[model samples]
Each structure stands twice: as C-alpha cells, then as structure tokens.
Target chain A: MGLPRKDRIRAKLKSENTTVRVLLAHPMHTGRAKDEADTLIPAEFIQDIRCWRNDEEVLTIKCGTATARNPYFSFQLVGGKQGDMITIRWVDNRGAKGTTETVVK
Target chain B: MTDDIMQQRRAILKGAISASTLALVAASGLLLPRQLLAHWPKNAFNAETVEDALLALLGEADIADDAALNFKVGSPPSYAINGASVPIQIQSDLNNIERIAVLVENNPFPLAMSLELTPAVSLPIKSMIKIREDSPVIAIIRAEGKLYKTSRFVEVDIGGCG
Candidate 1:
C-alpha cells in the first residue's frame, strides 16, 4: 500500500480573510531517539510545505527536525470566500508526501 | 537434543542472521546521509551564531528598522517551563511581505523556522519551536526588497537542548 493519508486540513472564511489550519501526522524524529535495540532512529521530518488557494500559491514553510511530532500549523489567507479551494502539500525526509484540500466555509 | 538446547541454538542463529543482514545493508551504502533525506538547510542550522545563520539564509544584506512595519509577536509568559516546544505567533501589517523567519538568539541552532508568503497569504504565521535557553526571539520580514526586524526576550527555566 502507498503511504497513509495523515493530513487534516480545515479552512474557514473570516470577516476579511480565511483561516487555514493543518495537522500532519508525522514522527518528526530528531535523529536522536533510539529504539529498544539502541539503534538511533534517523531524523525524519517534513522539509517543505506549500499552501495553495485555487491553484495560487499562498504560503510555504521550510521545516527542520526541531518541529514537534504531528506538527500543527495555522495561517491566514488575505482574501478568500466560501467555496474557495485551499490545498496543502508536504514532503518528509523519507520522500513521503501527502496532500489535502478543503473549501472555505 | 533437549528442548532448552534447541531453543538456544535457534536464538543464536536468528541473532547472527540479523546482525549479518544489518552489516550487509550498511556496507552496501543503502543508508544515505541524513541531510540528503530532507532539505535540512545544513548551513543555516549549523551556524554558530544568529547573525551567521541569518546571513546564510537571507544573505549579508543590511536590515533596516522600519517604523511603518507593524510586527507583533504572540507568546506565553516571559518565563517558559518547557523550552522544548514553545508556541509562537507572528503578525505583521507591512504590505507585500514576501518572507518571514523566526530566530531564537540563544538556541544552538538559532534559526528556528521560516515561511515564504505569496500575495494571497495574510499575516499571522503560527507555529511551535524549541529554545535552548533564555534568549531574544526575533522575527524578520522581507518586503519590497527591505528587511524589517523585531524581537522579544523569553526566559526559559530548563534549556531545550539537553
């Protein structure tokens, strides 16, 4: 099977902008954790994240291992209306990727 | 053979096989460097100083203090109990901001995180970051080819990087 879908995205239309919140399921290993066998778990984390609004790029984040597990991010869109498309995609250290979309409500 | 002896023999064989398999994988170079696995931005994260990290990420250009730029930082109490994960939010009113970066001045890796904004995005970028000790948290923004900066001091009881 392919990588699991682990992202939850939501968008809401506010008075003057749109709010987007994203919760991504990830280990965010800091390259320091060790297993029961004492093997160092390699650092695996989301390196890049991009958010698009109706095919228009709005925000991009560059992350590192310091990010916590199941990282959460929230940002605002300058102008968006109901039914507008908001898409977010991220790629992790293992080359695993996930994308999720929501409509502003 | 007795049951105990048979069990011991099987355990030893299993261990030997797994050890050899691990060695083979290591020797074959199947495990790539950790940096290659992600866009780690080694230079910025490895920089010894905040200035160095900013230079590596944003170039060695002069940053001007602009009064027109409305930059605000939202964080917890002045003293944080847990430095490993401190919630922070940045909001600005400067027009046409293209990039925003957060820096923890005293962290081993001062450059905490950064965000690139497009025209469709608004201000107020929120996230969590680790802080090594009591330090000034800086927020830098790039707009119209100029860099605007702001900072707030935060005291940590226990350092994050143990």
Candidate 2:
C-alpha cells in the first residue's frame, strides 16, 4: 500500500530449446544520512525474489543491500514453443509490489 | 624398430596429440557465448522511488507479479552512517531471472542497488548505499520478463547528516 514501487516479469513463448534473459529495476538504498533541511531519510531496499515459467516455479533468491541497482538476470527452459509466455514478480522493503510480462517467439 | 622408424613414430604421435587438443578446445566454443551473456541484470544505479528508478533501469514491458516474484528486507535499521554504508540485500527464487534492484523510502534519491544473474547460479543481490536518516528500504526484481517489489523499515541509531 504505502510501500515503495515493485517490479514484475513477462515474456512471449519461444522454441523449446530457446533461452531468455531478464532484469528487474530497483534501488538498494541503505538508511544512512539526512537531507539539507536536517531531515532523515530512512533505509529501504530489496529482500527476496522468485520466478516462474508456464505456471511452474523455477527459481528463488534472498538478497540484501550488498546488491547493486536494477539487478540483471538470465535463464533457460526446455519444451518452449513460439508465442509462449514468461512471468516474474518481486517485493521490496516498503511492501511495494510490481509485475511485468513478455512473449517469446 | 630401427632408429629412423622410431623417430617417425615419435613425431607422428606428438602431432596427433596437439591436433586433438586444439580440436577439443574449439568444439567447446559453441556453448561459450550463451553461457557468458545468458545471465541477466548486470548494471545498477541510484534513484528516488520505485517507479522512477525501475523505469529507468529495466524497461517498460518487462514487469508482472503474476510471475509470482517475491522479496524481503530488515524490519528497520538500528543505526546510521551520516550517508555511509547501509547494509541491504535482494534475493529472488525465480530460476529464469538475471537481475534485481533496491530503493530507499525517504531518501532524496531512492533507487540504490541492482545485480545481474547467471545461469546455473542463484540470483541473490546485496549491497549498502548512502542514506539520509530514518526510512524504509525497497527491493524489486525482473525475472523471466516480469517484475516484483518489497520494502523494509529501518531506524537509525546515530543522527549525522540529519
């Protein structure tokens, strides 16, 4: 609700042997300092990640501030045909959520 | 065998061994490129919010939660660095992902960390960035062409820049 923005993944179907790449956008903000007006900006960042293909869970991860911004990723799958779909989702420290999709051909 | 015959046999064996080794190395090249760039999320930059930073980093079409992406973070940081190292991490269980991102809740600039993934490897991203004061940390991911988000609140121990 009042959490920060989140991201998701999507894709088109492709050949069973074809592989795909994905990268989500986020900030690994470390709560540290204040602003010009003497205001404090709290620390916020990502904590976990998960993905699926054709309604089947495939991968999962647990991360923290040590990570960089807009993390990048790539993976492969078998038995995929053109026009198929790929989906991804993630959550951030603020409870914010985001979703996205893609089509492989 | 005679002296001449022995020398010829040694020469032939050496040539055969060298040729076979070279061929083997070349054959392996076919699968090398895919293995190199097949991973995702290689670059990272800072931003102020989840929406602005993500759009600047991942692109428009690659976002979805039905993708079932998930993430977590610390309840609230109990310390501060006056704009120094802020510990944090973002992890995704999605097998088809290549990158992840993090952001700050109240920072003048939010977007913080991002990481790229490689096949046959787990895509867990972590890092610490500068923060102003008390705020929440946000985490996001783009796996298999979808996106997801999460956040955590942190309390500063010492006040510096603030």
Candidate 3:
C-alpha cells in the first residue's frame, strides 16, 4: 500500500530544536511470513533513511528486517527554527523510494 | 498435414522466444535498481558475532566505558509476548555524539540498527527493534571520535529470529 509522501513526515519545532518523526508505510515483510497458500513472503523493508535540514544532511539510519512494519523514527534537530525546511527520504529493499519535506513548526 | 505441423512448430517457437525475452527483461528490471540503490550494511548484518558486526561496521569493537556518556535505554517488558517488534528508546547526553548503534548479543545476527547523526541533530532517538531471545542489548555511542558503550539485558519469552 502506498501513502501520500507528506503524510509520512511529522515535525515540530520546540525551542531551538526541531523534533522530526516519520512513519513510513511498508509491509516490512520479513521473508518469514506465509501466505494463505503457505507460500513465503519475501522480505521487503526500508533499508536506508536519510534526513536533511535545509540541504544539510542531519541523520542517516541503516535499518534491517528487524525493524517493525510502518516503522516510526523520532530524532531531534538542533538549531532549527520556524519555517526551516526539513526533508526525509527512504529506500526499501525492493528499491522503492519515498521522500517528504516539511517546514519546521 | 505437413503444412499444419509446420504452423504448429512456428507458433511454439514464437511463444518460446517471447517468453524468454520477457523473463530476461523482468530479471534485469529486478536487479538493476537493487545494485544501484543498495547501501545496507550487509557485512555487518550478516556477521555471526557482535564483535564481528561492530568491527565490520565501525572498524573497531573495543569500545570504552565512559560514565559521562549518560547512556540510557528505555525499559522494555521483562517478558515479551512477541519479540518481533519490541519498542526501544536510546538516548545519550554525551556531546558531539556522532553515531548510535543497537546490537542484541544473542541473536543470530546481532547488529540490529545503527544511526549516524550530524552535529545538528539531537542525542536520543526512538525506534522499535526485534530481539531473538533473552540477551543484552548493547547501545554504543560514538562521541568525539571515541566509542563508548553500555548494555541492558532483556528477557524475551518468545524469540523473534527465525
């Protein structure tokens, strides 16, 4: 299932730091699940995540199959102010990619 | 009868050629993107031991214990019904912290997750991870180019790894 890019990112500015939280929509199939026909579902998950603030990279997360479905990531960005641009992007094992940008609030 | 047989042979040949062409296209389509975008740490994730994983990913496993790091792990349930998705939070007060990695010592693949942080980002990050069995979850933080580490043992009732 695919979701609108903007819906995945949530960011709020608290004081000088902005807390950016992302909820990626993915099945995160661990390659261990069996379908009703008893067939294994090959693993599919977001393998890499990169976050940027105003074109400067802030965080890079290397994820594995152990990460939960519709993974949630929360981190802080220091020295961010209102209306600062924050962009988050991710790529899954299937080579699917998603990116979203939001202004710091 | 001879003409009918020839027609059937041509049809079969056409089908085979198209099938092979489709298969080749599909295989390349599936492979090209993975090779281009793949950046996951396969060596670290597939490492048999935590030390190997750490060495592969961080180039070292000899992390020192520093009391000033203020490393803290948010508590997880003592007995987890489903170890597949256990919520965990890691935070450190150490300044200039560059990276944080989570490792479950007893899992088949011990390296669970790692986050590289820029100076503009804050210290503590929260996420969910899987645990195979009862094991110590190590949180290693890189601060000022030095590796400092700590651990918390979590008792898992059901193993997550297959």
- What is the TM-score of each candidate's chain B when compared with the real chain B? 0.68, 0.55, 0.69
CAPRI rating of model 3:
acceptable
lDDT of 2 by residue, A44-67 (tens): 555555555557555554444434
User: Compared with the true structure, what per-residue lDDT tens digits does model 2 show for residues B1-162?
Assistant: 699999999999999999998889779797565454333332323444656666766777554444244443332444454434455544555666665666766665465445455453343343445455677766666666667766666665543122
Tell me the deviation in Å of residue B149 in model 2: 1.0
The most accurate candidate by TM-score is 3
Clashing pairs in 3: none
Instruction: Report the lDDT tens digits of candidate 3 across residue range B1-162.
Output: 999999999999999999999899878797574453346788887787988989988895568976655444334444466677677776677888878888889877788788887788885688877777888878888888899987877887777764
Q: What would the TM-score be for candidate 2 when compared with the true structure?
A: 0.39
After superposition on all CA atoms, what RMSD does each candidate show versus the true structure? 14.2, 15.2, 10.8
Q: Candidate 1, what DockQ?
A: 0.36
Question: Model 3: what is its DockQ?
Answer: 0.47
Q: Under CAPRI classification, how is model 1 graded?
A: acceptable
How do the residues A7-50 of candidate 3 rate in per-residue lDDT, one tens digit apiece?
A: 37878988777899888777777787688889998888788988
Instruction: List where candidate 3 sits over 4 angstroms from the true fold.
Output: A1-7, B1-38, B69-79
Q: How far is candidate 2 from the true structure (C-alpha RMSD, Å)?
A: 15.2
True contacts kept of each: 0.61, 0.06, 0.75
